[model samples]
Target: MPRSEYVASIRSRIGTDLLLLPGVTAVIRDEDRFLLARHQHSGLWSLIGGAVEPGEEPGEAVIREVFEETAANVRVRRIVGVYGGHPMMVTYPNGDQVGYVTTAYDCELLSPATPDLDELLEVGWFERDEIKTLPRRTWIDRVIDDVPRGSV
Candidate 1:
């Protein structure tokens, strides 16, 4: 998608006025490796997560989204932190805009299975060093570093 189209898509989703919505992001790790997805939207690597639907909690959203995108059953352990995407803007392919407030969590994989790639282009567990090398969004590095070092 072109940059202008992406920006327009984001604008449509968010509208002209900014809106704050609840979102969930999961940091699933095993043996010092974290699960990351290659986002289909912009081709940038990021954690598996999505918007928290009405009447749904952030943790619930993370679990559901992780399963849907990666097919890995996960249990959210704790909320690492909440981050605002105010300074940032996300644009979609259809010219929609989205302003996001993401609740990041430290989670563990409950099922010993590989991820199914429907929403995601690719999925894998990567070490911290490896994560640093991937073409990831700005928020990803902070999310990975904040994982309570040794929590996995």
Candidate 2:
């Protein structure tokens, strides 16, 4: 399920027009490392996450996305931040535009396995020092910055 049926329907009408969407991101941690996945299209590494489905809570969405993208079961320990606004907006290669109001969570990883879905090219655990050097977007960096300050 690359894009949800609901989002697909909306995109059919709006094309590349920006959609204000709810999303969730997980900063999964084990010991001193955090989990990140390479986006299939962008090839940039970022935290595991995806759009929040209709009727799904942010916490539920992160858990689902973690398993869907990493084949890992995780429990949400706490929320790191609620980020939105223009800075978090994204334009996909296929001309799908979305401004995501994302709830980023600090999650406890239960397992490490290859993704069950095809959205990610690879997955790995990275220390904070290494995460700062990755070719990721500002939104992802913001999420990572909050991990040490403790989830708020």
Candidate 3:
């Protein structure tokens, strides 16, 4: 999916100034491995998810986002955390500044993915030990470290 229409509209008026937005992140796991997407815009591996649309719940948004970005069907098992403040602030490649109030969830992939190349450079599953070797954003590492090992 593209930068959400709601966010796009907001960006049009705000330019690159910081915008506080509600979003969701999916921490999908398959046995001992976790699914992560290499962001096309950021070039950093991160959890698969996107913004919550108007009237959409964070849990619902994560399921939709996971499917849109990776073509993977998933069920949100539980929320890992509700995070914001400095850790959520980000500057996109186009200089759009956003501070996300993100509700992240642990998810179970119901099937294999057919990744959307426009949104992600690549998508793969990595074991916990292997995650340390990848170039990942702080939030990704934080979510992985924070979530319980046998949740989803």
TM-score of 3: 0.92
Model 2 weakest lDDT span, ten residues long = 143-152
Please tell me which model should have the higher TM-score, number 2 or number 3.
Answer: 3
Residue-wise C-alpha lDDT for candidate 3, range 1-152, written one tens digit per residue: 37778888887888999988898999888766888889888898888877899998888889999888878798878888887888788888888888888888988889888779998999898998798898887767777888777635
Off by over 4 Å in 2: 149-152
**Which tens-of-lDDT digit does each residue in 50-136 have in candidate 1?**
777777777888998887776779888889888876434576665456667899888888885355544567887889879889898
How far does residue 144 in candidate 3 sit from its true spot (Å)? 1.1
Local error of candidate 2 at 131, Å? 1.2
TM-scores for every candidate against the unseen true structure: 0.81, 0.91, 0.92
Query: Model 3, which residues run further than 4 Å from truth?
Result: none
lDDT of 3 at 85: 80
